[model samples]
Target chain A: MEITSDTHSQHISKQFNHELEELKTHLMAMGGLVEKQVQDAIEALLEGDSRLAERVRDNDKVVNDMQIKIDEECTRVLARRQPAASDLRLVLAVIRATSDLERIGDEASKIARNALSLVEAGRSPRGFVEVRHISEHVRKMVRDALTAFARFDTQLALSVVREDESVDSEYTTAMRSLMTFMMEDPRSISSILSVMWILRALERIGDHADNLAEYVIYLVKGLDIRHTDPDQLDDEAIQGKS
Target chain B: MEITSDTHSQHISKQFNHELEELKTHLMAMGGLVEKQVQDAIEALLEGDSRLAERVRDNDKVVNDMQIKIDEECTRVLARRQPAASDLRLVLAVIRATSDLERIGDEASKIARNALSLVEAGRSPRGFVEVRHISEHVRKMVRDALTAFARFDTQLALSVVREDESVDSEYTTAMRSLMTFMMEDPRSISSILSVMWILRALERIGDHADNLAEYVIYLVKGLDIRHTDPDQLDDEAIQGKS
Candidate 1:
C-alpha cells in the first residue's frame, strides 16, 4: 500500500510540495469534469435527452479553460521551482494528461452533437446496444486511468492500456455490425452513420484514456512506453526496463 | 519577412541557444516526415499503391521516436537550464507541436490502412475528387503550420487556422455527397464506406494541423487561443491580447 518512494513528499520546501499537490489536485478536478462530460453526453444519447446533450456541449468550454489554467500553472512551477527529476516528470505528466483530458472533453461534445442530430431525426438506430456497452467500457477506462494517475499505480495504468485493446476490438465489431446493418437496410444509412460517429467518438475517448494511462506509467517509471509493442510493455515497463 | 523579436537568440549563453536551435531542427525534421507521410498516404489511396501506403505505415515509428527524443531534450532543458520566459515558451511549443505532429502521423497511418483496404476492395467509389482536393489543402496547412513555428510567424499560423475551417466545410460537403452517393447506389456502400473513413482521417489531420498552428500562436503571443471563437481569434490574438 506504500506509494512508490513518495518523492513529492521528500521536497525540502513544504511550499514546493504544496504547489505540486495543488497542480495535481487541479488536474484531478479537470479529470473529474471531463468524466462527467463523457457520462452526461452518453446518457443524453441513450436517453434521447437533447437538453442534457446541449449542456455537455456548452460545458466543453470549462474543460478548455481548465487546460489553459493548468498549463499556465505548470509553466509557473517550472519557472519558479526549477523542479528536477520526479518533480519535473510530475509537472510534465500533468501537462500531457490535461491535453488528453481536454481532447476527451472535445470528443464528448462531438458525441453530444451527434446525439442531438440523432434525436432530431427521431429514429433510434439499432446500435444503441454497442453504444451503451462501449461508453460504459471507456468511461471505466477513463476513471481507472485517473485513479492510476492519482495513486501512481503502474499496475492499474497497465490495465487501462490492456483494456484499450479490447475497446478497439469492440469498436471493430460494432463497426462491422453497423456496416452490415446499413447494407441490409439502405434507408437506415443516414441515422446509422450518425451512430457510427458517436461510436467513433467513444472509441477515441478510450484512446485518450489509454494515453492518460501511458502518462501515468511514464510519470511513475520514467519509461516512455508510448508506441511500444503492447505485448512487451508489461514485462519491461513494470519490471523496470529503464 | 523579419522574424518576431528573435527572443530565442537573446539568451546570454551561446550553448543554451545552440541547444534550443538543435531542438527546433529535430522538430522540423519530424514535421517534414509527418507531412510526407500524409502526402504519401493520400497518393497511395488515390493511385492504389499499396506499397507506398505500407511504407507510410511503417515509417510512423520514426515520427514516434522523434516525439520521445524531442520530449526528453525538452525535459532536460527545463531541468538543467531552467529556461524562463520566451526560451521556455520555445521549448514548450516544441513539446506541444511534437505531440500534435505525432497524432497527425497516426492519422496518416490510419489513412494508409484505409487506403490499403480501398485498394484491396478494388472499387474506387466516387469520392476521389474530394479526397485529392482536401488532401492537398491540408498538406499545405501542415507545411504552413511548421513554417509558422520555424519563423515565429503568428500571421502564417492564423492563416493555417483559417484554412482548417475551409477544409472542415469541404469535408462536411464531401460527407453529405458521399452519403447521398451511397444511398443512391447501395452496391457501392462498402467501398464508399472506406472512402468515408479516409475522408474522416483527412479531416482529423486538418484538426491536428490547426492544433499545431494554435501552438505557434501560443508560443509567440503567449496567448492560449485554443477553444476560442475563430471569428474573434484574429483581432484578439494578432493584436497582442495576451
Candidate 2:
C-alpha cells in the first residue's frame, strides 16, 4: 500500500511540473513568432520587398491565433489551478505581454502595408536617407527589447527604454526632412504622406517595445513602473558593473 | 415542508439575480467612465484646455482601479455561479469590453498629454481649424461607438466602422499639409512635428473606436470581422440603410 501511494504522488508531481513547463513553452513560442513578424516587417521595408510585405499581412493571422490560444490557455489555467502569488502574477503578466505582442504584430502589418505602397509609388525622395536612419535605430531598439524579454533581463530592458528618446529624436529629424519635401512640391505630397505613415509606424513599434520592456520590469520586480522615472529603479547589478 | 423548500428556492434565485444585476451595473459604470475620458480628452484638444487635459490624466487612475475590481468581480462570479452559454458569453464580452474601455482611457490620457504640450508650445502649425475638424470627427465616432455598445445596435456600430475611412482620409490630408509646411520652412519642423503627433493621436483614437465597434459586432453576431472587409458583412443590421 505504501509503495502504491508513493508512486501516485510522484505521478501527480510530475503532472504538475509538466503543466508549468508547457505553459512556459507556449509563451516562448508565441514570443518567437511575434519576433519574426517584426523582423520580417523591417526587412521588407529595408529591401522594398512587396512579397515580404504580403507575407507579413498573411502571417498576422498566425500571430492573432496565437494570442487567442494563449489567452484561452491562461484563462483555463487560472480557472482550474487557482494559482496564487507569483504563479498568478506570471499568468497575468503573460496575458498582458501577449496583448502587447499582438499589438506589435498589428503595427508591423501596418508598416508592411505602408512599405508596399511606398515601393509601388516608384522612387522615394532624396531625403529618404533620414527615414532610413530612424528606421535602423527603431529596429535596434525593438530587437534588444525582445532579446531582453526572452532572457528576462530587466537591466537590458531598462536600457531599451532609455534608447527610445534617441529614436524619438531621429523620428523628429525625419519628420522635418519629409516636411521639406512636401512644401517644396505639392506634387510630392502623396509620396511624402506615405513616408510619414511609415515613420509613424516605426515610431509606434518603438513605443510598443518600450511597453514590453516595462512589462518585463513589472514581472521581475512586481512593481508597476509605468509612467514613473526609470532612474528610480534600483539596479544593483548595474551599480556593481559601474 | 414543501412550502418551505419552495420559498428557499425563490430566495436563492433572487440572490443570484441581484448579483448578476450588480455585475452588469458595474460594467456599465466602467464604460461610462471610459467614455467620459475620451470625450474630455478630445474636448481638451478642441478647447486647448490644459486643465481638462490634466483631469483626463488624473482620472485614468480611477479607470485602472475599476478594471482590477471588475476583473476580480468577474472571476468571482464565474467561480461562484458557474455561468454558461449566453451568461458565459456576456461575462466574457464584458471582460473584453472593459479591457478595450481601459485602453481607450489610456489613449485618451495620451491625447490629453499631447494636447497639453501643444498648448504650451503656443499655436500648432496644422492650425486650429484642422485640429478642430479631426477632434470633432473622432469625438463623434467615440460617442456613436459607445452608444452602439450600450444599446447593442449593430447597425450603428457598422456605420461607425464606415466612418473610420473618412477619419483616415482626413489624417492623410493632415499629414500631407503638415509635410508641406515642413518642406516650405525647415524652421517650422518642430511645431509641425507636434501637430502631426496630435493628429496621429486623434487618428489612433478613431481606430480604437473602430475596434470597439468591431467588438460590438462580435458580441451581437459571434462573428470575428477584424481584418476582413466591412462590406463582406452581409447581415441586414450591418447593411443598415446603406
Candidate 3:
C-alpha cells in the first residue's frame, strides 16, 4: 500500500501522481488476486476440494483481464506523461510484474487442473507432503515479493530471490523422492505423475515469484540483476543506487 | 530481417525511425539465437552430444544479455521518443517478445542440462522419437513466429498460433506413452523422467511461440486476443483492424 510515494511524490502535476498511484493500486490488486489463486490452488489440492479447484481454474480469466488492463494503462501513462527516470522504471516494472503475476495465475490454474485430475484418479499419499511444504514456501515468497513491490523495499526483494534457491532445492528433493516412490510402487505411476506435475507447477510459481522480486529490485535500485548470482545480488543492488 | 518498415517508415523523425528499426533488428537477432538454442538443444539430446549441449547452456548467457540490452533500448525509446499508437505498440511488443525469447532460452538451457544428464545416464532410446518429433514441431513454430514478427503478417502469426495446439496435443500423447513406458520398466524411470522434463520444456517453448504470435497480432491489429479461442482469433483479428 505504500506505493513508494515517499520517493516519487515530487511530480509537478497532481494528475501524473494520481495516475502513478492508480497504477500501483491496480497492480497490488492483481498481485493479491494471483496470490489468493496460488493459495486456493494448493488448498484445493490438499483437501481434495474440487469445487475450490474449479473456481481457481475459472478465475484465471480474471487475472488475464487485469494484466491486459494494467499493461494498457502503463502504455497510456508512457505516452501521456512521458515520465523519465524512476517513473519509467516504475511503469516498466509494472508491465513486467503483471506478466509474471499472470503466469503465476496460470501455474495456479495448472495446479487446480491437476488437483481435479487427482480427484478422479484417487489420492496417493506419496507426494502430498512435499506439495504442501513447497506450496507454503512459494506462497510466502509470492506474498513477500508483492510486499516488496508495494514498499519498493530492495531488501525484501533480495530476500525473495534468495528464498527461490531454497524452494528449488526443495522441489528437486521432492522430485527425487517422488520418482523413487513411483519406482517402488509402479501401480502408483499414474497418480504420482499427476503429483509430480503439481510440484513442477509449484516450482515454476516460485520462479515467477522470483521474477517479480527482481522487477522490484530493478524498479527500486536501477539495477538489472537478472542472470546474476544471488550471492552477488546484494552488493550489485547496493552499488546500483550510486 | 524485414523489420516491418513498410508501415512504420512514415515517422517524421528519421532518428526515431532508426531507433525503432534497431530495436526490431535486435529483437530478431535475439529471436534467432534462442531459436537455434532450441534446435541445438534438441539435436544434442537426440545425438547425446555432450559438447553441443554444453554450448547450448553457455549461449544462454548471450541470450540473456541480448534481452537486457533490448529492454534498455525499449525503455530509452519510450522515454525519448514517447512514441504513440502503432509506434508505441511496436516498442511494447518488442519488450514482450524479448522476455519470451529469454524464457525460451531458459527452456533450451533446461533441455541441454537434461540432455547432459541423459548422456551421463546413457541413452534409453524409448523417448527419443517423441523428443525429436516435438522439438522439430516447436522449432518450426519458433521460426515461423519470428518470421511472422519480422514480416508483421497476421496470417502467418495465426498459423503459428494454430500450430501450437497440435504441438500441445503431441506433447500430451508423448507424455502418456512415456508414463506407460515407466510403469512397464521401473528401472527406466529416472531416464524417462528426464525425457519428460525435456518434453515439458519443448511444450513450453511452443507456448512461448504462441505468445510471440499473439504479440504480432497485437502489434499489427491492436487486438488483445490472449485467452481468446484460436478458432475465433482470425475473425477477431480482422475485426480488430477495423
Give the lowest summed-lDDT range of ten residues in model 1 chain B: B1-10
Q: Tell me the spans in candidate 3 whose CA falls farther than 4 Å from its real position.
A: A1-12, A236-242, B1-12, B234-242
List, residue by residue over B72-183, the lDDT tens digit for candidate 2: 6765666666555455545556666666677778887887887788779877455557778887898888778878877778889888888999999998887778777766
lDDT of 3 by residue, B40-125 (tens): 99989888899999999999999999999999899889888889899999999999999999999999999999999999998665
- Residue-level lDDT tens digits of model 3 in A1-242: 36667546554467798899999999999999999999999999999999999999999999999999999899889888888899999999999999999999999999999999998787745889999999999999999999999998888888899999999999999999998888899999888988999999999999999999999889877788888889876655453553
Colliding residue pairs in candidate 2: A179-B183, A180-B183
Candidate 2 residues lying further than 4 Å off, grouped into runs, are A1-20, A76-84, A126-166, A173-192, A217-222, A234-242, B1-30, B48-99, B113-137, B144-196, B214-225, B234-242
Pick by lDDT: which candidate is best?
1
Candidate 1, which segments miss by more than 4 Å at Cα? Answer: A1-12, A234-242, B1-12, B234-242
Question: For this target, which candidate reaches the highest DockQ against the unseen true structure?
Answer: 3
Better of 1 and 3 by DockQ: 3
lDDT tens digits, residue span A48-162, model 1: 9999999999999999999999999999998888899999999999999999999999999999999999999999898999999999999999999999999998888898998
Q: Each model's TM-score, in the order given?
A: 0.94, 0.73, 0.93
Task: Estimate candidate 3's alpha-carbon lDDT, on a 0 to 1 scale.
Answer: 0.91
* Location of the lowest summed lDDT over 10 successive residues in candidate 3 chain B: B233-242
- Per-residue alpha-carbon lDDT of candidate 1 for residues B1-242, written as tens digits (9 for 90 to 100): 23434654454478898999999999999999999999999999989999999999999999999999999999999888999888998998899999999999999999999999989888878999999999999999999999999998888889998888999999999999999999999888888988999999999999999999998888888888988878877665474544
lDDT tens digits, residues A1-242, model 2?
A: 99999999899668766765676678778777876777787678777888999999889999888877777776666655655545555666676677777887888888788778877887555455766776677767767776776676888888988888778888878777777766676566656667787787778778777877876776666555555556665677432343
